[model samples]
Target: MKQQTKQEILYRFPDGFWWGSATSATQIEGAANEGGKGPNIWDYWYEKEPNRFFNGVGPSVTSDFYHRYKEDIALMKEIGHNSFRLSISWSRLIPGGIGDVNPTAVQFYNNVINELLENEIEPFVTLFHFDMPLAMQELGGWESRDVVDAYARYAKICFELFGDRVKKWFTHNEPIVPVEGGYLYDFHYPNIIDFQRAVQVAYHTIIAHAKAVQVFKQMNIPDGKIGIILNLTPSYPRSSHPADVKAAHIADLFFNRSFLDPAVKGEYPQDLVDLLREYGYLPVTKEGDQKLIKENTVDILGINYYQPRRVKTKEHLPNPEAPFMPDRFFDYYAMPGRKMNPHRGWEIYEKGIYDILMNVKENYGNIECFISENGMGVEGEERFRDEDGMIHDDYRIEFIREHLKWVHKAIQEGANVKGYHVWTFMDNWSWTNAYKNRYGLVAVDLENNRKRTIKKSGYWFKTLVENNGF
Candidate 1:
């Protein structure tokens, strides 16, 4: 096969396109017990059951951003990152999740924010990224209405502290992940396998998002934009059969619309509500929740597209005794002949990014959006090292380039997308998966006291971001 030149690339994004990476506190900041940081649910969970994590790794052994943020920010500048996204650990700020603030943690975050600004890097800060304080979880987590108010208080505190420097603020990162991981999928802390509780958790999360938006608006911070990050998995049916189509629709309703509708459209899908009602799984809501959601929808949306969901008609009859499962009406189908991310076991469909953008444009009113987290994860990446200490990450480069093409096409078609940020800045400890999959432009050498080395993809991304296109 003949090689194609860069000029022959099909899609090119607009000028000033943001190209950076994302990381969360618990994933990268390893000072879990230091700087007056209280134990989050993850810390407590890992302590109780270290075996639950991959390789027995936990948050306490993250990239140590708390100590190395300055060096990391320098690397970000070197890699041509004009902007970056990170989250503030709520537990770090307020140890009990609702009381007095931690002065040391506050100073630490202030230093990080200021350093990023000094380096001319735009900081997109998210308020939450699944690291709830154990104290808060003890109060029933997202299942309690009071916890929503507590979250608002936490968001307000962050706004007051960081809003002056951080222009872009996100309320939550992939809110549905916690509901699924914690309440249904049993991957996150406080893991439960109850569908009713899952629905309630999802419901309360939306309410919390709306309440945070309300708080943000009330704060009157200049140039501030508050939004929620969603990991949207575009659902595709197996065929044109009505049953297959219906299955796809329900899948979309459960995974996509459950949060998308409320965050963007300010109302849950009627079908979802009906399904919950039929099964008596509807979460309790206050009188003013609908109005609050409608009046205070997100100013922007962060789209994190890693895969697509292909669905078909259910293979088996629904279990009557099972408490309200979303997959009861559909079956997940692995499309044969589809490309796959072998390391992560996710189908790598580039067009899924376009579909997600189009859905936001057509159905969700084209709310301001960006690719918040999209990247490939690899297992045991150290095997690719060479004599020069560089890892040839061409696979990651191809993954990003293909996805950026779709994002570019969507923007050209008026999708209102602003930028793209990969899943991570460097390899960090994921909750339970815990360093099993590395998704980073710069690899961290864990054995060498957590040394950072820029991979080949880092050099490639520097040029891509500097050029604003590939």
Candidate 2:
């Protein structure tokens, strides 16, 4: 007689857990010029400085999601996707960002939403994903209060149009990226290194977010949830020394708490406020902005964790004549022997996901949340393709598995993490970097007339979703 074998125990998730992927309009949607769409900052920037983008590739013809939504929706269902996050192009919806709605854009979005619902996949809609309408940008962008009001109008229009079918609405995605990219670091359009402008931009983004949330509440779509997606990088110190810890705390205040506090707690961190006050970097505010923000905090939080920020005390004092910047308070400390994702140069610290969720649980009233964006981007992914036209991406499987293990641990520890969505569903155009790094479960063959092929990891992910765990 054969010996009896033990059944393997599996890590299981709660019933009805969300399993899907996220994408942005500007990154995925091609046909940038068609459908009566107006130029956003990206289109304008790419036209002016073609070389600024990777390999001179612009946003005009990306993944061609515009012409192939039906096909893409079918592929989404082919995988184990129960939910998908996509953004409405403000430029496409309201060409000038503050005028009449484009009927063409309206019809396009409705069809996509209906398709997702028909396939049993929930649609998560985001209002803005760093694609500012060129007209709005011309009006001084976020520096001018008029643009904030414009954003509020745009958000309201979106709610009224799609709020009936789309239940999950997000005000902004990684609102800080614009401040750092466009203002502080000169990586985005209208690049400038003005810290004052960066502060103003950051402050206004929160206000705009709150205004959208307020509009969402007023509309009161049944089962609707409004929130913001923030890329929260846990700040870690080189050592537990007082100076190192203090430096890390300040780094957190600048990067994490700057947006997290106002969105969740309805107030800015006192230390952050005091530091800004000391430096006279406070943004211009109107009389009732505080009241508006305090009364309109988010209903849920979308935490996008990629890596941890390791900081140490500044090695040397800043030059008095130098422009103001966040690094004035702390210096980056790269830990030796740390694992890294060489393709993206991002540290692969899987436990950071658990740390972020635990922090939200302990400090942020245990509000409902989810892993909105987490994945690895590898360069030259074509080199890994096999004879069967499939890309055997085992590394992506390992990366996601490590992250999910920590997510499961967080759930066990009482963190109210509701779902986990990878960074993207298909290989799409990344801003500036274009397609230098691919972070998709499905590969797009640019040489093969933009054909779509699900990678090995996509099959693995489908099984993972079926099991709800590894």
Candidate 3:
């Protein structure tokens, strides 16, 4: 039997299942230098090397959200967004990432939050989203205990200021990206290829996350929930061979469990610890750090699933002379006949979503969770626009439908999944890629005075939210 009827009820999400999208401060809110905002790494990096970003376009004026948030929030209500997730820029909230809070930044965030509440959209706030203040970077970024302490203080300040209204909080989004990009791959600012430093950066990030959770608990905000947002990429083996399975397991340890285990289970995986210790790469830790992490496990989790990773046994031994990398233990396997997002160079395997939810259910205590981010980014989206000025993005609609089907299956099988939030509500600046790809339901016209038009997918989304299913 196909079991189709048994699973159909799961497709309709429970009432108050948090229908919305996710966005970050740097990605959407322009006015980078205005409104008394201090420079984050993105602002500083773009100034240092304009050529590094695609088409030399930076984040100084992304979608002008600072000026247009009211309009955006209204559009969000129109699209049936009962909830939304956005991040606070550390540099903007507290200039230099420490000490006195910026009054102007406070007013801006207050306005945004108030507007969302007025529109009946519950605000979900994140404390960090990869936009480290340049001042903090100079003070050793996440590698130093000082910065971690500063982050804790900042989190406390945020709670005291906004905790009364904003109940759902997240400490960090995709925390591993900085460890991989800035310290390992040289994709982010302060690009330095050093494994030991990367390990320390990753460790301190966990510490910072724990500290934030600790402070959030102390505040005792009624009905408040604190969590971390991790981009979990399921690791699959190329074959059933033992070696391939082992290789995939190691990849999972490094990429997924390194953060997931700590945030959810309150401890690091033993195999990950053993591997790091074997390589003399274990991060430096302080007394009580273990207790801190163990005691501050998150109240919820946010899973950002965009793709999966397929790996196999290494074909060749890594050069001992070369610096360490995760691939030293496994090699990427380009699965033949798999679907691909050619625009973003990512494989599209919808089953990965179900696999992730099931793992969380079986391994992570079935923690309350949601699909925090899942969307398709496409190049040349404007080419699909019709005579009515609406983008006919049927491909994106199908992409979302396929992914949601897997989510429905996961829920039917008893995953404690709560809701789904797309990557964004509108097209905005994406780090170094500039505007090369559009991942929004609402098209942003960068050339036509930054006009906004509802895409075909946007209307379809409103219907999905209204019906609570396709």
Candidate 4:
């Protein structure tokens, strides 16, 4: 009788679960200059040097969602998207970051929001998604306090305009990407290599985020919630040795805790502050910043987990004459026996999602959060197309399933996990990657009028959303 009573366990989520994908304005919306839209860093950078982008294919030739958003929204509905995350282009909305609101741009966003509502899809809107208005960059970007003030004003305007209808708002997405890609790595626009300047940029971004939260709270949009989306990469020490442990701690301070602490705990790590001060590389801060940050904390968190960072103790000392860098204290250690994603060369670590959620639950006051972005990017996917003209992307299906299993485990263990949103809904131009890597459930034919077709994983996702479980 006991054996007969046993049954398969169902990994079901709570009611009103959010099921969707995310996309940024610059990556999806073409018509870069239409509808009174000002040039952003991407637009200016492409015009200045097209070769910098992948295959010299700039943002101008994206999926043309500007003219096809209605059709695109319907596709989202068909895919069973109850909620979706979309960033509002600062360049398009305020046109130069601090001027009059463009009526045409306003109308476009209004229509998009209404369409989503009409389709019963909740809109998760982000204010800035790395598409800095070119005009703001001219004034020193985030390095200057003026840009920070302008960003606060822009956040206020967005709340006033759309906060009434759009309850979920995000200040910025992956704020550290600019510091890493632009200043440290030279992968983003206005590329430079300066540790001191990078410190300043990162500091100003925190200030800007806190200020935005303050404004959002003041507006008092009914049931409105504001948060920051951080791409949290957990640091694992190579061994339990003191040196390896110290190296991992430093890396975590530099990458994860830099934003996580202030965003959640409303405080910066004392050790990091001491290190910067000892090195004489501390970024400038103003009076009342401590108070401002403490008083305004996020109501939610969006964690974008792609890969984990593995670090080992440093063997070589840095040259006294060489420039200061984050890697000076440690080096990345590629684990010999780790799962890998050969398609894109990223590590296949599904448990990283559970690790992140558990960390948030244990260390960050159990903040309400979700898997905001997770997906596989496979190039040359066209070869997998069948005679039926449908893509059988089993690799993507497996990737998502493995990750969702961990998510289910986390939720069952009480992680306050809210939902799971993939990296994107459709294949669109990446930042400088262009169309080289495709990470979408729907494939866009780059050559054939940018046609859209659902991949195998998309159909599976629709079923998963409808069933709320596998």
Candidate 5:
């Protein structure tokens, strides 16, 4: 085989391309219960079953961003970061998720936002990041329509509190992850396996997003944009057979179109609605929901693409007696000769990002978008020790370079992409997986007072951002 050189990469992004890193409050901020922060779902869940987490680690012992944010921001500026994305915990703001505001938490967030702006770094703030307040979860969570209203109110409070400094606001992060992890996979809190409940939860989340957008519009905040972050997984057929094609289409509808259409177009896809009606799994909707959704679509989009789905027709027939299942119509097929992430067992196909951008451009009106979260996750990464007590993560550098090449290609082909933010800034506690998978340019040492060290990828990313491409 012939070799392709770096100059062979044909595309370059526009001037002022945003190159930064992202992290959630609950994942990186270790002051879990301090500063008037009440219990979130993660805190409550960990208290119940500590063994469920990897290495028995929980959010209480995270990257310690609460105390080290000033130093971290300095590092961000030193590494050529012009922007950073972070989330505000709902329970931290409103302990009961609905009642009075917490003064200490308010001051802390204001300080963080003001500090970011003072340092000339744009802050992208997300409202909810899979950390539902325990009080709200007890009230039927997303399964009840009332929770949707509560979420909208919470979002409005955030806008009123932080909209002056935070120009870009995201309603939710990976909305479908809760439906799959909390409802189907039994990996998250309130774990259950009911497709009907899952459909309802998904529906309510869309409603919450629409309501939040409506509130934002009502506020009329100048030069501010509100959007939702979606994890778009492009689907590919195993073969050209009619069954395989149909399976791929259905999978795409379920995974991508289910949330993308409503967030972008203000309406769900007709095919997805038809499938739900056929299976009697359609979520109950109230009056005016259709109009609300149609009127308040997102002003921007955040795409988080990690991998694609290779699907084939299901070999087994549907069982009438069993509860509804999404995989009943299609089966996942592991592609032969596909590149793999040895540390995390995930497929690495750089083209998936390009295909995702193209799909959004062709089918979703080419909305303004950016890569919200993309990175390689490694398990037990501490074993890669060196004489200097630093991890030489060259593989991570290669992973990001391959993905950026595809993103650059998509931008050249007129895909309306604006920026790229890696999944994290430093290794922190993941929700259920805890600290097992490290997806960060900066490594955090959990021992010896939670120290942070820049990895090789961090240096590479700094130069890439400085040059706008490398």
Candidate 6:
């Protein structure tokens, strides 16, 4: 008798796996003043000082998604995208962040959502993505409780308008970024160096997210789930020495647990609370703020893993004259012999993804989650294009494959990972980077009428989606 043949096992994912990419409205939509859209922080900042951006480029020079969304949606369908994550521009929908809805903006979003659905693409919508309306910022941004309540109203409008068709909703993306960027660092708008304001802004943002989640639950939309996207940077110590380990633990408490605990476990870390209080930097909170945060937790999570944080115990005391910040607690130590992305100045540690998912699984009750953002950025991609006019981006392909391999392993070990979405779908404008580093599978030809061309990795990703595996 002939020997029986065994079918080979392939790297297949779970049923209904989400294979898509993510983009923010300000980064892709270029109609800054059209469609009845008011200015966001980017718009207002660009108007004030355009030279701060890379190559003097601003958000107004994005990929023109506002007018070319149909073609863009076609490209997404061609790439075998089953889901996509997009943010509805608050300034566009309700100009100035809180007021009557702009009918033109409503029509545009309706068209985009309807087009995606018609093409069999599921929408994972985010209500806030770091582009708060200029009017709201004028009212003290996230630092003021007025802006917080206004954000809650904006979130409610999003649910009432788009919740019926969009099943997955996220309240905020990288909520801590604005705190660090605007208040601690000088990269974003309203650049300031005040730790107390940073603390207050961070607190109010958490409260706004909780209120949004509360409204999402109260709406009782069928087949819908709500969550937030967090860039959970895993902190590692240089060595197992007691001081180093303690430093790393404190780093974790400050960076990860500050938001992770409140978002998932419905309580802030007591150590962090005490630390803030000790410094007299505790944010102002109302009587029922704790109850609001405790009662309104997310149903899912979006983890945007790009890099890891390595630190060692501080070597020397600060000057005691500079502004106070989190770095005062620990020093960032560059790991010797670690892989690095020279273009982005970030360490390319693929195992970081697995570590994040494992942490979520073991400590955070294995809540439903997905890889919301992961990709490589190439600074000078034009040099790689061939005679056929297609850019060969095998490095990005390998980068994603290696990351997904770890993601697959974590899922098999019960990490509750639901999907993998790339950092972006196309080479749109970055905040200050201004396309200095392109991370998209599809290249946007800025010099040639903003033409879109799918790179080699884009086609390879299409196959990966079709096979549901490698």
User: Model 1 segments beyond 4 Å from truth?
Assistant: 1-11
lDDT of 5 by residue, 1-470 (tens): 12334574344568988889888989998898898998999999999999999889888858888888898888887777889999999999999999999999999899888888888889999999999999999998999888889999999999999998888999999999999889987888899899999999999999999999999999999999999999999899999999999999999988888999999999999999999999789999999999999999998999997887999999889888976778988999999999999877889999999999999899889999999999999987777767787788878889889999999989989999999999888887888788888998888887767788887788778777756786
Candidate 2 stretches greater than 4 Å from native: 1-9
User: lDDT scores for all predictions?
Assistant: 0.90, 0.92, 0.93, 0.91, 0.89, 0.92
TM-score of 1: 0.97
Model 2 weakest 10-residue run by lDDT? 1-10
* Candidate 1: worst-modelled 10 consecutive residues by lDDT: 1-10
- When superposed on Cα atoms, how far off is each prediction in RMSD? 2.1, 2.5, 3.0, 3.1, 2.8, 3.1
TM-score of 3: 0.98
lDDT at 248, model 1: 96
For model 6, residues 198-223, the per-residue Cα lDDT tens digits are 99999999999999999999999999
Measured on C-alpha atoms, candidate 4 has an lDDT of 0.91
**Any residue pairs clashing in model 4, and if so which?**
none
What tens digits encode model 1's per-residue C-alpha lDDT throughout 1-470? 13345676556668777779998999999989898888999999999999999989988859999999999999999999989999999999999999999999889999999999899899999999999999999999999887888999999999999889998999989988898889887899898989988988998898899989998999899988999999999999999999999999989888989988998888888998997788788887789889998998889999998999999999989888875567888999999999998999999999999989998899888899999999999998999999999998889999999888888888889999999999888998988888899999999999999999999889888878766787
Screening candidate 1 with a backbone cut-off below 3 angstroms (N, C-alpha, C), the clashing residue pairs are none
Q: Write the per-residue lDDT of candidate 4 for residues 1-470, one digit (tens) a residue.
A: 01111133266777888999999999999999799999999999999988988789999859888898998999999999999999999999999899899999889999999999999999999999999999999999999999999999999988888887899999999999999987888899889899999999999999999999999998889999999999999899999999999999999999999999999999999999998999999998999999998998899999998888999999898888877888998999999999888867888889988899999999999999998999989889999999978898999989998899999999999999889999889998898888888998888998899899999888988877877877
lDDT winner, 2 or 6? 2
What is the overall TM-score of model 5 with all chains considered together?
0.97
Return the lDDT, model 5, position 228: 95
Ranking by lDDT: 3, 2, 6, 4, 1, 5
Error in Å for residue 68 of model 6: 0.8
* Residue pairs clashing, model 5: none
**lDDT of the structure predicted as candidate 1:** 0.90
